[model samples]
Target: MTGLLPDNDLLVQFSQLFQQRTSLSNMQAHWQQYHWKETIKLGFSNHKHEDWKYTSLDRLLQYRFNYAQKLKISKQQCDCLALPLDSHRLVFLNGRFIASLSDNIYESYQVSSLVEQKNIPVAVHAEVFLHLTESLAQESLLIRLAAGKKSNKPLYLLHISSGQTDNQNKNIINSSYYRHHLLIEENAKIQVIEHFVSLNNQSHFTCARLTISLGDNAQLTHYKLAFENQHSYHFSHNDLILGNHAYAHSDSFLLGANLTRHHTSAQLNGKGSYISINSLLLPFREEICDSRTYLEHNKGHCHSQQLHKTIVYNNGKAVFDGILKVAPHAVRTDGKITNNNLLLSKQAEVNTKPRLEIYTDDVKCSHGATVGYIDIEQVSYLRSRGISKTKAKQMIIFAFAAELTESLKNKIIHQQVVTRITKRLKRIDI
Candidate 1:
């Protein structure tokens, strides 16, 4: 629950579980500083909440979740996930960072736990879940790239969850909470790749948040891959802020998860800053995926581009809401937004909303959204080329997704993303 729910039972259970684990004066006092007491009183968001209106949490609220604890899994099993093997890598299992699995690289970047560096910059729109993660997670991963420093390799992160139901703890569901902070100082450059998966391929809920700050002349490139099992629920938020001459490129691949909601907000606050966000949401077999993105141009000479593509099949549903806001003084702001979706079956559907709110007359902004089935003309062309009907459909779907995937700069990561999407498409019912 986001602490906005009417049900006090979960909050009670969570409090009770905390009390039962340790003495009130001991570890129990640790959870209080998170400001959860006030947030819980505010309660869970309903259909009336504008941002959450399209996606319902009723299906997820039926289960009771327990806070995840640290556990060790086999090395062979870790390899099975095919996680990226970057030189500078950090691994977190169930929300707990594993120092043993993390790379001890130094001299190029600064990596510390939130416990040591408590001064984290709060983005503009801090949500209840961000505070909730702070109250529960004792330690969070914090990475800071030294100003004017450039890294030869990308920073890799593996966030995996694996476990069965917590039967011993009153049958509580196993849910994990994780928080990460990234700082790119002035004139610094860095690349980060994050892979989220269910290590055991089991059902669970994951709440995650990533805060990014880019200083003047800094550049950060981020790629996120979410491949949780369809039986699981996952929610995440990305808060990114850019400074003068800063640049950002964010690419996301949403493949699985029974119920997934992702909120991304980016603010270009300094002149000459630029941002490009591209996403591919491919959900199959009754999964529900929702992506909400907001881009704000607060300064002049800034540009933003967003291209979102989704393929929903087997009675699955996909929702996308994108907003581009330009400040009154943000002259010469340029933005482009496009959302295209393909529904394979009659039962599959999508809801898309793309808007532009321009406060100044000196901005150039445009948006377009389309939802429909595959073009019969293209399918027929492929079929005439001796391709099977099923294979032809698959080809067209891949073509639609390739438009965004081809924009990726890292070949290794690009291959991995393409392979995952192809594998998932192969398993979909024709």
Candidate 2:
């Protein structure tokens, strides 16, 4: 196996497995014949590849990986993953949906085992989506929302994996990877919350694929939070497509795991579409957090804004790379993006990049990034008020993360995020 390209063995095995399972034989053959060899032929990692420079997947490959085996989840366990909202909840254990643990809803929405579906919407049937799909293990656990319907309550999707239950935990690194697909139709107002949790302190890998389509006047909000154990690794890919007059907002909170990488790519194809993205990432002591986003305006009169904040404590490290692209025909498009970091200790590290690529002269776009320490004035003021130095520092750190937490829109979720942040702060040494 080449040292440059990570996961060479898995890549080869997945290609063979994908070709045998997929009905799209032509595409599968194309990947197996060309893409597979090209990817694995590389002896060393193209670390300089701008997109991969920040988060080093190759370095992760050097360690042993424990591939989690598929497991069955009982109906009782599915109930625990149900959301507070009027959502259709489904549980996937070890990457396979458990029918016994799911509700059968065929009229309003199609809720069942994801393995039942053989095809996805055109919005998600793209080149990049296909490549990742082929490499990921297990058929995706799917969720399809009907058109023109508004969900009374938000949707909650819990991808729960108990390594002990799978018995594959004894593998070298014990990494588990998951692949799933979701689709939302037109005129639907849906809020989706995804939670990643583990029961043991084993090294794991989780990879998820999400495809969301917003029809005319549709509204959607997606919130993804990661709370994995110390030795786990997570890689997630999300794709969103928006129609005319549609709106979508994304909120993410990454607080756990030794290494976590989240990638989001959105394309605005319709006029009058709008999107806002907000994320809060806090990494502490040996934790590595890497996030990347790509937003494209393919048509005119589209707008997007992104704000990401990172707080690093102890020897933690973080990376943020954001790109906003406006196509040549996308006149009157507007976009603004910012990535900022608050470093709590000298040992903390941060890397931020906000990039803009515009091909249309009629568009307005801006991008920037900032990295710095806590505000001395705020700390000093709290210290003068009889608070201890350590306590004062904690207060300031929480305040910095408040901006991201307050954007949750849901009061309950906002409060939960705050509570989780506070808990992490308490666990760390000031």
Candidate 3:
């Protein structure tokens, strides 16, 4: 195929699947068709693209992944992967929602599987994967919190990917697509956690999209946990919009997948809005992790803060690209971004870029990045205190990551995050 359209095996497979699926509204079908054609015209990005300079899709595009078939999984299987928190759970297996496995919500909240709700705008992006998701997604979810109400418990959305087993007892490579939307009305508050995991060590591909809208004075706390297998590939996009005096806090933990990319964009469209985003990435062995964030200050008296940390080991690589832009009318805008990376091996690599674009002279903005190895001085000090070299190194690594984990206000979630980080850090050599 000359582009991503003519004879691409992945597109061909998804086209067939799309034709066989039913229950799509006329408007939805038209929307999908439009995006599919746009995807073919735009094609995929390469290293030459400014936004994709550090991450390449060559490895991910080489595989011919079939659509993931529905599989039967017990609640026990999901429990093993879930965090110990009291929350209402919504489960999805292989991109299809399982109503039997989900918990019922109260009357104060509105939840449904349909995507044809009014006032929900479709995603428009130049990226190929996003367009593909818009074209091929077979499952969708919409959650709305009523005005002046707050959720008593958090909402947990768990997405699990599992491949089919062949006659030779090997797993088949497959793909799944999903889309989710969350809406918080004025004076409402809610907390949400989106967890991604795998049932087995199967090679698969997952593409997901999430769009969040906060009305005036709304509050939201969001968390995303990605713990897929090392043989899988994952791509996700998040778009957030904040209204007047709205507040939003988002935390992302990336610790798995052979190749992964997360793109997030936040817009402060109303005055006095605030947003804070934090991310932790651990790429070990030959894995690659890429994260990108774009913040737009469209109104005055808005503020934003971002902190990103990455730890690389062996021959792994990590990338971070962040940009904050203030419009001409957005006076009194405050924005700050910091990125720190730790290299555990000489072969490990990190690529970081934090930029600011300001059109208003009254705004305050700063950006910085740092990349270095563990301090030998701290290790020596720990050794003199009768700690073993391996233990000392582990302690330092934990402390480096604790900055983000300790920020979690929920005790159960804080402990769970710390435990996962400790378990992953055990693989590093002293």
Which candidate's TM-score is highest? 3
For residues 319-392, what per-residue lDDT tens digits would candidate 2 score against the true structure?
Answer: 99888989899999989999989998899999888899999798889998889998889888998999998889
RMSD in Å for candidate 2, one decimal? Answer: 3.9
Question: What tens-digit string does per-residue lDDT give for candidate 3 at 1-430?
Answer: 2334234545565567667554358777776788788766766656666666777777765555677888877888778877777898888888888887788664466887655746775552346777777777877778888899998888888899875466353434678887888889999999989899888887888998888999999999999988898888999988889999999999999888999998888899999999998899999988999988988899999999999999999989999999898989999999999999999889999999999999988988999999999999999999999999989988888889888988999787777777777878776675
Which parts of model 3 are misplaced by more than 4 Å? Answer: 1-23, 122-126, 167-172
Q: Whole-model Cα lDDT per candidate?
A: 0.80, 0.71, 0.84
Candidate 1 lowest-lDDT run of ten: 19-28
lDDT tens digits, residue span 186-247, model 1 = 99999988789997656787878888999999999999899888788888888889999999
Q: How far does residue 390 in candidate 1 sit from its true spot (Å)?
A: 0.9
TM-score of candidate 2 versus the correct structure, residues matched by position: 0.85
Ranking according to lDDT, highest score first: 3, 1, 2
- Candidate 2 lDDT (Cα, whole model)? 0.71
Ten-residue region with minimum lDDT total, candidate 2? 121-130
Model 2 alpha-carbon drift over 4 Å, by segment: 1-48, 72-86, 104-107, 112-133, 164-171
Superposing every Cα of model 3 onto the true structure, what RMSD results? 2.3
TM-score list, all predictions: 0.91, 0.85, 0.94
